[model samples]
Target: MKKSLITSLAAVLLLSATAATAQQKSMGGMQDMPMGKPATGQSVHMARGKVTKVDAGANLVTLAHEPVKSLNWPAMTMGFQVKDKMLLDKLTVGRMVDFEFAQAGKGYAITGVK
Candidate 1:
């Protein structure tokens, strides 16, 4: 019985070790890539969604959004600036825009609107 117990314990240890290694390998794959600083001259292709709120006073536009084919986002609604207030003239609540822009001294500012 002692021999059997020892063997079972050893098997459990081996399986746990294997699992730990696999988990480590998987986590290693998700490590953030080092690029020194965020990419420059980067244009964000905003996700397809309608504007939820437009606060011109704050120079902020909130969007009920999905993933932008050109940018990576995980939220449904987001607030970003219209690169130029002129772009605001073109956008309306509930309208969709395939906008492009990059981060500036403040939040994101529009570089292009389509």
Candidate 2:
């Protein structure tokens, strides 16, 4: 009876760990994967924010302004890697603009800005 109880407890513990891992996956862990509309079963759209900083060499920019549903970020600062060099010139810090980006597996890259 003791052995059976131990086995049952172990099984419950394993299941709990798996559930926690899954929750973290959807939330944001270290290097959390990008969230997509298709994966969520709803048409996801590009989130827009104001440019705070830009690094051409790194092809990255720091944005702060509003919330982004795509990445599940609230009105806060966030960093995004640029997909195209042309986007560098288009970014204007402290200016509001409409934009869209594509997920490059691990990080994200801006594809459109207007």
lDDT for position 63 in model 1 = 63
lDDT of 1 by residue, 6-100 (tens): 55554543454354335445644433222123256444444456776666644556666665433333444545666678778766787887666
Show where candidate 1 strays beyond 4 Å: 1-40, 69-71
Q: After superposition, how far is residue 94 of candidate 1 from its true place, in Å?
A: 1.4
Whole-model lDDT per candidate: 0.55, 0.60
Worst 10 residues of 2 by lDDT: 36-45
* Pairs clashing within candidate 1: 47-68, 65-76, 83-110
What's the TM-score of each model vs. the native?
0.53, 0.56
In candidate 1 the C-alpha lDDT for residue 14 amounts to 43
| Alpha-carbon RMSD, each predicted model | 19.0, 15.5
- Count backbone overlaps in model 1: 3
